[model samples]
Target: MARSYEANLETSDELAAVNEMLSAIGESPVNTIEGDSNADVANCRRILNAVNTEVQSMGWTFNIEEDAILTPDVFSKLIIWLPDYLSVKAPSGTTVYVNRGGYLYDRNAKTDEFTQPVTVSLIRLKGFEEMPTQFRTYIIAKAARRFNIRFFGAAEIEASLQLEEQDAWARVQEFELEYGAFNMLDGDAWVAGRLTR
Candidate 1:
């Protein structure tokens, strides 16, 4: 299910890097199963195993969450690594090359009384041509950097399409990721993440 594309699209490396990173995070599949609250270590193992299946089924594609990392500097690396066909332009007008989809917006504007547009643009470099799907790479490259990553929820999915659109706006119509769902681990996020790898 990999989407093939032009070799020289913008941010190809960074995009590839992100893709590579995701491929690394969840490649090793472990088997486990789900159980009631009393489920012990064995059950946990089962759940982990199930996660592996989840990843395999997904063909290893992952979505980086955090609405764009909290630290703006982190994104600079991506901007610097992007190819020419695509470019990233921050709300502040800071620009970079990127080919796929990116979301850049100010979080401080999310409130009701906000004066500025508390929204971001989900930029797409290609015409829904490519998206990452390497399981482990997807998790590390995409899930780890975000403030929180989440599984594509029922609301975030549209059964009619079977998959989300290359652009989140279209996909968003099908599934959703929420803040509360994320679990805090070691002062970082471990929840709101998907095993879709």
Candidate 2:
């Protein structure tokens, strides 16, 4: 069947990612992704989500939030739920915070209960559409490579796709360096070095 460019114009959504995966495996593009779909469509969608989550968990500048205020539960006055937080830090305090069971757990206090508001820096997972074009492109490329391997297991094709994935990753790393403004002075290692000196 002849495909219209208009139908595939919006390329930032999960459907586009799955369709790209389909195309990578020499399959026809799917129009829409839904629960009631073919096995390939379902598997592609699942793999895409898994890959997206893995990528976002790396704490990119786009996904990380700084100085976020989290309040305790109104009724219980404890257990601040942060279901989307992949990584978290107290920022500046005696408390050591960790996300456990989708809630804020205090390692210093040995409890999940919080009596007052807490300020934290955290990385949260974002949906595919919410990602910038660069990130989305990288994710789509990586997902396609994985999808190709799962169904075909063709060595030559997988090798070529691995290079594509690596190139996409390099672009993402460059984007991160430009936008993340990473500095050795800002990290804990530098602070420890100064203290020792």
Candidate 3:
């Protein structure tokens, strides 16, 4: 016999996040994007895009796995253009190195005859539905702050939203630290380790 259980999941979508931002700014919630000519909806969409961009720039723990075929050539460089590729987390094996420009470098110095698929894990922006509760809240606060500054131009509201944004960011930092998503070491740390030994 197969075991069965009921699960209660809290899921959010793009419209939900948008509505959250709108509600934060004292606006009514929108049902759908279709046939909606409200400026608030447009602004919400723009803010959502900006929020995703900002979050991706921060490089969170959310990632997607992809494979790119290494083009065998004289230079032994592979051009990988994965959709929405932010940064390569790691390659499948130790033989490959991700260059500064997101290109793959074959450390083994393979010749032009080497043609194989390289598996890569990369950091990417999560879809609205996939975002965690903390991230959604952060996006709402950040979007509201941006929207308020651009349209309302009220100092008092802007200040309040700024504080909200700061608090949301602090929560993001805490979550990242707890989940090991924050990178604590850099190149200098490697040099320091060598000196201590």
Candidate 4:
């Protein structure tokens, strides 16, 4: 089968944003309720209803309202709602809030943060320790599965004995890229080897 899965750089930024939001949620207040318990429950129901509207727009269905626990406002513009995915209970004398791997709404805060679907391929590279861990991991994974290529260690050594300044391997040279000999020294250390299943 042909390798159809390509590593998407755009998704890296998206994942980073998602992670940042998760961090923000972890720090910020989740929920606060004034008035009686009935009003608090109403607020949760409203938040969940709004969440349904938001999540459905992104092609996902959720039960945030039914699963959230209400809490007193510890901080302004915050209402914590734990998602169902997390098996947590309400704190003592406080409501529990959950929104698993997804978005939650804060009516007072006027924000609705969400979790999105993301995918990535990790690559691994030998010889060139300078290669990015993620890029190398992706390359290695792709190589193993797609190329069925087995080889020796790889060395990105400069063929030209020139006094380099600033950096090495700046330009992608043909001969500069060298592969190691199979069974060269150790079992590992292949220049551009990738395994497939």
Candidate 5:
């Protein structure tokens, strides 16, 4: 049968991404994402998720929430369930916060309790579908490169995949530069000090 050369208009999904990874390692694409009974498919899915989480943890503007308020639970005033934040901190203060036992902990205050609502700036984890297209492409390319290296370890193929990975990374960086609106004042201690005034 002849394969059509039609362009795909839809954006890449988890299945597509996994298939890309599988293809990188000289494996056939799977019909479904999970429970494929193929060890290679399972490995691809795992690598994809791990790569997604790692990339999101880099704190892109898309995943960052500013001045988000997190209130304590009414039933358990002392236990505030923390969001899946990659890194979290007070919007502006010396106060440091950490995720401890899936709860928000005040490192500076030495307490896990919050009497009042806390405003924070955090980079939260977003699902694969929630990620921007540029980031998604980058994650898939990176994952494919890693999978190829882990399984096949072919020097020539790795070199080719590395080029793709680097190209994808450059695209992601370009997207960030255009949309992130980053300035020197971002996360500046001096600028944060002024917010207190």
Candidate 6:
């Protein structure tokens, strides 16, 4: 006999976040974005996008590596093709330099010749769905707080929402610390060290 297990699929990250925001203000969850009569789904999506942008700006350990061909010329600089590239990590076997524009330059100007593509590791901002649970909670709290402010426009509610947002962010920080996530300073140093050399 073969053993079998059942798995339950949950709502999508966007729907969950929107529902979380709705539940925060004592509203019922909806089945679909378009079917949500109580909330503006488009506006919720915009809020979620904003929250993702803000959270990503804070920097996290989310990253990916890719091989990119260096644009070899007299300038000795290489431009990364990844549009979402945030910062570059130290690559193997060679000293690479990265600029604010995500361009990589060989530290040794004489070694500009590249016969093959070089692998570059980068720290990039994750999409909303790619965020960890704690980060998603933080995003929901922030989105809720913003939604409350926009929908209610009541000073008392604003104060409470602010507190909720703060608490949510605190939880996210705690989770990050618990999981040994990268600190902003550490990431900065890693990049800065390579750039200076």
- Arranged by lDDT with the best first, the candidates are 5, 2, 3, 6, 1, 4
lDDT of each: 0.29, 0.77, 0.63, 0.27, 0.78, 0.62
**Higher-scoring candidate on TM-score, 3 or 5:** 5
Model 6 worst lDDT window (10 residues) = 2-11
Q: Candidate 1: which stretches are off by over 4 Å?
A: 7-85, 95-122, 128-197
Model 4, global lDDT: 0.27
Where does model 6 exceed 4 Å of error?
A: 1-11, 34-39, 63-80, 86-121, 181-197
RMSD for each of the candidates: 19.7, 6.4, 8.3, 25.0, 7.6, 9.2
Candidate 6 C-alpha error for residue 16, in Å = 1.5
What TM-score, computed on C-alpha atoms, does each candidate reach? Answer: 0.16, 0.83, 0.66, 0.14, 0.83, 0.59
Q: Write the per-residue lDDT of candidate 3 for residues 45-64, one digit (tens) a residue.
A: 77777776677656675544
lDDT of candidate 4 over 38-82, digit per residue (tens): 432333233323322332222111211223343334434333332
Put down candidate 1 lDDT per residue, 116-186, tens digits, no spaces.
Answer: 32222223233111443333233222222221123222332233212221242333323323322434543
TM-score of 6: 0.59
Better of 2 and 4 by lDDT: 2
Q: In order, how many clashes per candidate? A: 43, 0, 0, 31, 0, 0
Candidate 5 lDDT by residue in tens digits, 72-170: 887676655444567788877467788788788999988888888888878777767777888988998998988987878889889989999899999
Deviating ranges (above 4 Å) for candidate 2: 1-12, 92-102
So what's the TM-score on candidate 1?
0.16
lDDT of 2 by residue, 1-197 (tens): 74321122234376778888888777998777764459998888778777887888888989989898888988776765545677777876456688667678889878887788888878787766677888888988898898888888878878878998899899998999899888766557768689778
- TM-score: which is higher, 3 or 6? 3
Candidate 4 wrongly placed segments (more than 4 Å): 1-37, 60-197
Error of 6 at 172 (Å): 1.8
